[model samples]
Target: MNEMGKTDTVVQPQSSLLELKKMFFLYLPVCIGGYIVFRVLIVLPLWFSSSTEQLSVLRIIFIILGVGALAVVVLGAVRAPRWVEKPIHVHYRHWAPAFFATLVILGSIGGHLVASAKINSNLALEKVKAHFEKETAEYKMGRNAQ
Candidate 1:
């Protein structure tokens, strides 16, 4: 007979799949999301910009906006939407571990994109600006001579 004050509690160990789900949710949102967010919030805006002649104020503004997007994504562990949650629930049985492992193998490419966006975008623009300016100067000299 069990006493009213005593209760036996049963605890089940988490499966390996759950561990993979945990890890996938942990890194995917903030890291990959941050990279994707950068592409959207920063790089996309600059893509068609005409005045990329300098490391101007707009670049900084977009970077700050990207950071804001990254901040929102960082909370993904707690409150992802149903569209995303449904996949985790459905895939946990079969694909969660393999998917997580694949992400682990491929994660660095996204990281490199983020890093390259921050480092290379402005430099590339500046290079283009310099080449254009040189051509303009040469054209001006030829026109003046004629």
Candidate 2:
């Protein structure tokens, strides 16, 4: 105890924290690049493909990714304190929220686009069917008149 009758504490930053910070800085760029590559090479092409069945598969993929994002957020929340002390899991708690948000945003946008595309294609098909039916009916009436 000092003459002031108060406790004095000295705080020192842990080296593991520093290393985790370094790892996070390195991981940020890699994660962004990976996301971009996956989006361009896989997601965009699949989403925009002319094949109707491919959209179903793309929908499933986005659903799974969205679920995974939620899981990561929940897991991080439950394990954050312990994870912060562990070097291997330290940075995940910090990044999981961002990851979750990105997944959610992308999933919503993709879902909307897919739904619009399907609706437009169905409308076009219906229009074409109606035109064909009208033409067939007119031809039949002309044949009966003759």
Candidate 3:
């Protein structure tokens, strides 16, 4: 109590970097666990029961995990200030993990695009090869008839 009969309190300043590290340590594991559970419980069984390739399932899972991590990091960045009641500094160490994850997500997207293009180009080459073979066969047959 003070002379005026009112209680006083002192608030300590909080570190935003520490809070951000804690958020990453907390949320990343949860996202990884969800990814594993989804892959094992849902995708694995369906994959085994089906008779075709499951490459697309792996791609879908990667996409879901990437989006989930991106969302989590974005939410954390937005809400951290509200929790700390102060502006966050633009420090590389503070945001490195989120940046790395974002980079990985972008790399995976690029890889998928490259793979799709290669597959499409291969299909086109096969089509051209088939047409060439058909033309040569027709030429041979017409020459023999003449």
Candidate 4:
């Protein structure tokens, strides 16, 4: 009731539960697509490199980009509008999902880095060995023909 003895009518914005659910649904596919692209295009190529110097350069780049993306997400969450902010009472619980999502993203990026570095290092070593063997064989043949 109002101070003037009139009923106070408060208008609240309608909750968009359906919209929220749709947004989450849309996010899943985008995340999956990003994961696939990163794995196939970026990670795989870096992993298969024949030069350790090149792989190291790539590793640094990937690490920087991954960290930058995480920072952006954290900053965006912190600066979210007041209307989207959860009550202090439920803040921890509300943040759990975001925390888990960030962990997954970071973990995947780390995994890609580790896997690519290992594969690239191995590939580079093998290439060096092959080149040495080829050069040795050619030297022996030249000596025999002289």
Candidate 5:
């Protein structure tokens, strides 16, 4: 105020809080809905299958982490509108974008892990079948020679 020689009005913190709260309230439903849909339509079915046990524990861990990432994405969507309302000097606000980005990256990695695990398992099965066929053919040829 002294620099400008003008009166400086104090901003009410409650106004900021209220705006954030309203944004969260509005965003929460959409986030929750998406979370529920993803769990039901995607994660649950994949995890529930008995065949999933053939996957490595690390793959399962990645899937769990992906679920957590999805949760964070929902949370970020909820908070994003409020952050856009006014610029604040809080560290959390500064970190929000990074946090959201990490969530997306983690989720993508997890998804890739799950898919690769499945593909590797299928390839292994095919290799085993080929080896068995080759051994059978060799045994049959030896018997014919005898």
Candidate 6:
């Protein structure tokens, strides 16, 4: 107590907290973008290119990176209101960045899914055709020799 009823308090340095928050707000988008690239572009390709024996390990790494990136982006978005300032005029400009990023993310995932499905379907069709051809060849060879 310092005065008749007021409590005494020590002065606190606000610069550190202010600086940390400033850094976070400034680099928030960059961090999210980098993580997205690492997760989708780099980690995913590495996982897909890995051999069967090493696939599991790479898969785990991909999953971890993906989850971490998602978490970071989500957290940043959730906390955006804390640091982001809105303009006096209403416009689509505010939402454009997030919208485009989301569009790219969805497009990439959808493209990957469709491409993988097509490749697998083609592989299966090739297998079926090969099986039929092998059966016909074996039958013809046996009959001709007899």
TM-score of each: 0.29, 0.52, 0.46, 0.47, 0.43, 0.42
lDDT of 6 by residue, 1-146 (tens): 86588887886545656655655565566557745653464334334543433444444554554455455556546645423343211123333344445434553454344435545565788899999999999999999999
Residue 97 in candidate 1, Cα distance off native in Å: 21
* Model 4 Cα lDDT, one tens digit per residue, 62-129: 66666766775687588554645543323333444445446445655765567576766788889999
The Cα RMSD of model 1 versus the native structure comes to 10.4
lDDT of 3 by residue, 80-131 (tens): 4343444343233345456555655554565445434444565688899999
**lDDT per residue, candidate 5, 64-100, as tens digits?**
6666766765666665546556634343454444455
Model 1, poorest ten-residue lDDT window?
Answer: 100-109
The positional error of residue 58 in candidate 3, measured at the CA in angstroms, is: 6.5
The global Cα lDDT (0 to 1) of model 3 is 0.56
Candidate No. with top TM-score: 2
- Model 3: how far is 78 from its true place, Å? 3.8
**How many residue pairs clash in model 1?**
0
By TM-score, highest first, what's the ranking?
2, 4, 3, 5, 6, 1
Question: Where does model 3 exceed 4 Å of error?
Answer: 1-62, 79-94
Off by over 4 Å in 5: 1-17, 30-102
lDDT of each: 0.51, 0.63, 0.56, 0.61, 0.57, 0.52
* Candidate 5 clashing pairs, residues 3+ apart or interchain: none
Q: Where does model 1 exceed 4 Å of error?
A: 1-11, 29-31, 52-57, 66-146
**Candidate 3 colliding pairs:** none
Model 4 spans > 4 angstroms off:
1-17, 46-48, 82-108, 119-146
Question: Which candidate leads the pack in lDDT?
Answer: 2
Q: Model 2: which ten-residue window has the lowest total lDDT?
A: 37-46
Residue-level lDDT for 31 in candidate 3 = 59
Clashing pairs in 4: none
